[model samples]
Target: MTNPYKSYLSIGEKLDKSKFILATFHLQSENQPPARNASASDAGGFDQTAGGVAAESSVGTWTDVSLQEKILWENLRGRVVELDEKASIIRIAYPLELFEPGNIPQFLSSIAGNVFGLSEVSALRLMDIELPEVYVRSFPGPFLGIDGIRKITGISDRPFLGSIIKPKLGLSAQEHIAASMEVYDSGIDLVKDDENLTSQTFNNFYTRVDEGTKRMKEAGYLKEGRQKIYAYNITASYEEMLKRAEYVVDRGGNCLMMDVLTAGFASVCGIRNRNFGKIIHAHRAMHAAFTRSKQYGISMLVIAKLARLAGVDSLHTGLLPAVFTRDTCLTW
Candidate 1:
């Protein structure tokens, strides 16, 4: 019997020099019927009607290929790189030229598009992406990386100490100021609002910023030559988010916190592009909903890379003895 994946292997080999996307998918037996007539050589052929094979015209038969079929076979088709029957894992390679530069929405739609809804797969997960240099260089990376962060905070030695205000919400503006005062007095180099704490009736965002900074100055924390960073959560509507960021900066607050996942990457880019001159602390709240499932959705590593590209000064990697599982924590 001929190898069913011959076409896929050939396509992959031909595109070896070009940029391509590497995606790992987990296949479940219940979703995919066993292949019957298909051999190893023909297995990689896209033929949805054929058991376990993706439906499409063969790349080898160019004469019979239609315009759509030709475009798909040549530019959009996913070439099988590896298949493990025992583990039910399949790795596919897709040419990178198919994707638009610096656009995550379009990039994801192409790489992780309709493949998931295939009745042949019970669950699908994008485990990793080997982005090419050209693609990686297309996006603007972190504006304030580790060195820049250290320069602003003036901590040359050891890891900088930071904390999140506990009891995430329901604190009034005065209460927030009092809490911040205690935290600063305790010598924590940085303090931030919880991801869920934004402009609310109980604690208005502007009031918190005004009160927090005023107390920080009056307590002599700013005069003592110690620059205590306060990252007020600015997660809100697109307009409100930017407004909150501006308010913080106007009030002498040097840092702004954003629930990056909830606020969306585009909003982050907007803030960064505005040249606000305030540090951006990225909060990964609500990330686990999609990221936690191993058999479906994107991974946190991919999210982190995207966040860095969006220009966050710092991001939450995870904390010890916390909610995240051991494996999940390690992955971050």
Candidate 2:
């Protein structure tokens, strides 16, 4: 038999002491097949498939269990420990009630037999049920979330209006900042540097931030506290980004923005974990490579969860009721 998550069980009980371990699960089994002659050095190796060791076998299948909501079985840290057992191939236990109720079934179906336990059909009919962390774990959402954003900007009811300073390919720093000013003064809620505006020879980031943020601030005062602007600090490196962020704050900029996709996951996570005193606006630029294919690409829902975990205060989720239309606003 296989122990997919034994060590995680002991770690789970002591997770409070170390935030590093997201979640853990304990799998018990009975009348299980004996462990094959696998080498200890091959514990985490990937070549086990070519070593001729037989994989997990299933006994039964799922039938017709149905549920209204989707189910999710998350492994917060994405690691599992194992435990020895006695008839069942393996019995897994996880935290109950923390999932979104939208991805559970698919998850159960995936781990069936050969890996964790349940058989194929049995996995399919698992129904929508919440599991305990002993089985899985989810990460922390934005330190300052959507509600925090509204509070920070002092806006409520409708969505926070936003736009990007564009023509990123051709605009000079002055032109870009000037365009930003137009959006700021128009009483729009937010303005951002399109992802491409990062320290291009045509537009130095320092010069643009100095000019754009200054104008936006003036416009904010004239709006009688109605609208606000956020300048993106998508500079070259982490330190540079942080430096630009500080500069923006020093100039009294209210919010900050970034193209999370362009910067990479760790960058987003680092920015989110900081105490920047501003709403972290995340742009999903370059997301198509991972989300364009329905079957092959990752689900937007999953990306959203990871973004939240990485600390994005707000994100650009295509326009409301305008995803597949012709007009810009009609099909964003």
**C-alpha lDDT score of every prediction, in listed order:** 0.69, 0.49
Model 2 Cα RMSD, Å?
Answer: 12.6
Compared with the true structure, what per-residue lDDT tens digits does model 1 show for residues 1-332? 44332444432254563477666655554534434565554443232212222222112321233455645665655566666656756666766766777776676666566655654456666666677778777776677678876776677888978887767788898987798788878878888898888888999988899898898778765542357888899999889988888888887888888999888888887888788877889988887876888877768887787787777888876777488775456444
Models 1 onward score TM values of 0.82, 0.57
Candidate 2, residue 6: the lDDT equals 23
| Candidate 1 lDDT score at position 170 | 84
Q: Give residue 113's error in model 2 in angstroms.
A: 20
Candidate 2 residues 202-243, lDDT tens each? 888778777766676565542434537565656457888888
Model 2 TM-score is 0.57
TM-score result, candidate 1: 0.82
Error of 2 at 252 (Å): 1.6
Candidate 2, poorest ten consecutive residues by summed lDDT: 50-59
